[model samples]
Target: MIEHKPLRLLRHLAWIPAIWIAWELLHYEQYKLLGNPGSVFLFTVLTDWLGFHGYEKAMRLGVGAMEIAASILVLIPRTQGFGGLFAMGVMSGAIFFHTVSPLGIDPYSDGGVLFKEACLTWAAGLLVAVLRRDQLVALFNRIAGRDAAVPA
Candidate 1:
């Protein structure tokens, strides 16, 4: 019952991006949820620029909730692919806002730390998605009512 070495290595490697995405999402949850100054500022600028001034709180809370969900999903072995997809979606919005809104690359003026993190997390999520593509395909098959079995 010996597994091929490359397969074993790949299985182990999949956890790296999953853990990195989850850690970043969870670490920032408090700031987003608790109205930390930086988080509030970022959201404010985004909402203002997007003409959603009155909905800043809603947008912030919604993004925070999604991040929490993504973190939870990414940490679970069975749902890692979905989590990666979710993380990528969320980070995509963040990256888009950072680039398009008044919130430029260096929003906090800290040399674009937040912007860089979003980009890195987006890339990591892509890796997770690629690594767990089998699960993603299976999920798609189930949703589409297609046969899930693979030919031997």
Candidate 2:
């Protein structure tokens, strides 16, 4: 199949956020991790601050796994839109936490770099979604099993 250059370029760019986020969460030892004290502390604080405690590890591991999955999916040509959608979801949560939770924009107290990265990633994912809109529409049409006529 002939590759569309613009879509292909966008697809490649979309992988940046996914891979960067997944790496931050997983560190190449995603599966082997069982929740570190740092992660536990952060999640604990998040839960307590948000009153969503009692599932700290689940939240951490679950989001991390999803981020990793989204990253992997973005690497494939056929699933770029799905991956972008998944990434947008994950980044949305991250941005929410950074804004609302005690985490603030500087969770690590570094200098808000993490928050900035989250924003960038979210924006990139959104861009990818927009660039791959045709694919998303096609998928939706397939799933809905009907072709809706587009108004000129």
TM-score leader: 1
lDDT of 1 by residue, 39-89 (tens): 988898988998987887899999999999998888887788888899999
lDDT per residue (tens digit) for residues 11-56 in model 2: 5675665455445544623432566676677777887887786977
List TM-score per model, in order: 0.91, 0.77
TM-score: model 1 vs. ground truth = 0.91
Look at candidate 1 and give me any clashing residue pairs.
Answer: none
Candidate 1 lDDT score at position 138: 87
Steric clash pairs (candidate 2): none
Predictions: Cα RMSD each:
2.7, 4.5
Model 2 stretches astray by more than 4 angstroms: 1-34, 147-152
